[model samples]
Target: MNKYVLSLLCVSSMSFAATPFIYHDFDEAMQIRNYPKAFALTNRILNYDGKQFFELGRSLYNQYNPSVLPSRSEPIIPKHIHQIWIGGPLPEVFKKYIDTWKQMHPDWGYTLWTDENVRELFPLHNQSYYDESEGMGVKSDLLKWEIIYRFGGVYVDVDYECLQPLDELHHLYDFYTAYQPLDAFFVQLGAALYAAHPEHLILKHCIETIQDDWHHKGAPKKSGPCHFSKSFMAVAGENGSRDIAFPSFYFYPLGSKERVLRRSQWVREGAYAIHHWAMSWMPINTRRQEFRTFENERSSKVWND
Candidate 1:
């Protein structure tokens, strides 16, 4: 069943109804550095079943740090978000975005899934980071997609700023993604998207099918769909409910020929989210022509609003 289809009212009732299952993993604990909280939350979730194995793992974790418990109340939100997972390491900067989100939508609530505690409950055979770009015979990016298939809710890059209510995206489609193609032209990345939607098969397939070739070819020479996560949409096209692609201005600004081309499209289309894949805390290029799109849009009524 499409969980979100349950009308906002019904979703609210079941948002935190089911306790998440857990597994045991030592590496995850070290990486996330939050073993105590993870173990404590697990015990609370599995307290009713009295499962022997889970009990043992919970005991081990608790022995190390006795003060952990399931978040009595997940930060409240308007609807139920099945499972929200963040793939990378949790850094301090990311917390600012979370705070921004909370400030923007006080009622919105969602749980965060991290590798840190997941392995403790459900152990996986392979858990390490690898980076390979195009034709390098590397499947590193696949990590993000794997999580998307199993979870739902919004998946955003740590660098992205929460500018508006996520609820607004509910009507657009089952998925949403940034669009950045290389060409010194324009394209979006897949850092932000709605996952756990059945339609996401399109994105999953696109990544598996196109990533190697796109990376090998590099930017400027790459085709539109070949760009990877940026254009990857929910396979379920427009079915009364469909995935929509927002403009770059929402995330990335026009700062160069590449920026201009990419941001121009979104400028004309007027996007809801701006991707900062190429531009993080610093500017991409100094050419005023390039920054024009992002700069002008940054001060516009749309940006201020």
Candidate 2:
């Protein structure tokens, strides 16, 4: 398997009070600008395979059983937001996008995980993957799990713009995630933006899903949103859900009809955040140009099939 290409299995580890850490005035020089160069033809082929969602879902379901997690709900989740960057210095626009996050939620704590200190999050066994893994998308997917399981807060991509304080949404669920599009329903979950309380079973299962498949699969695909949906749906079935899945309007305005950011600065009422669809994980060449079209193909497979 080409370590440079981001595989679909999103995996992670939990060792101690020493899993990865984040927050506080992070580095100004963040590699958060554009994605890197072209991927090998072989790697590209592997990534495209995950478009088969039903097969992936069934495979994941067979591997994992639902967890009867504790009856924990919102407000229990920490008022923290975790974002990660693992490449060259970030673009100036990103700084502004993140700063808006701070301005909107003065009460919430913010953490920016970056390469300068990424090793601080993973364990010894996974360190080799970290060193060898080439795609920032893969690394970011791994980092989000650690942060969610350890810190218990909201996680967003650098491109997400905060419209209002997240207090209303964060204080409602123990392991809540945003859907991709209301029209498609449970077709896909936005892996990049989700919330969880520390130690939630769904998050652990997410970690396990990635770890179990990491050897054969690349992450940010196999281990990302699709993996998360399996864990979430399984757990929701085992234990009645509690404000667990939210509509796209909550955190995914860009993917929905009310693309407020594109038409006008004002979003429809009740929207809290907007993902600008800044696909930093995409290969910087022709593959990136096909980013939206590729993602659209995901709709062909839904949660049921």
- For model 1, the stretches where C-alpha displacement exceeds 4 angstroms are 1-89, 109-113, 118-140, 181-184, 188-190, 193-199, 207-241, 253-305
lDDT of 2 at 16: 11
Tens-digit per-residue lDDT, 128-237, candidate 1:
21222221112223434444544445555443434345554443335554333222222223344444353265456644554344433322223222334323422334
Q: Residue-wise lDDT of candidate 2 within 72-105, one digit each (tens)?
A: 3547678898988777666554665687677666
Say which candidate scores most in lDDT: 2
- Clash counts per candidate, in order, are 34, 18
Per-candidate TM-score against the hidden true structure: 0.43, 0.64
Q: In model 2, which runs have C-alpha deviations exceeding 4 angstroms? A: 1-74, 124-128, 182-186, 215-220, 237-243, 256-266, 285-305
Candidate 2 lDDT score at position 7: 17
lDDT of each: 0.35, 0.53
Q: After superposition, how far is residue 15 of candidate 1 from its true place, in Å?
A: 24
**For model 2, how many clashes?**
18
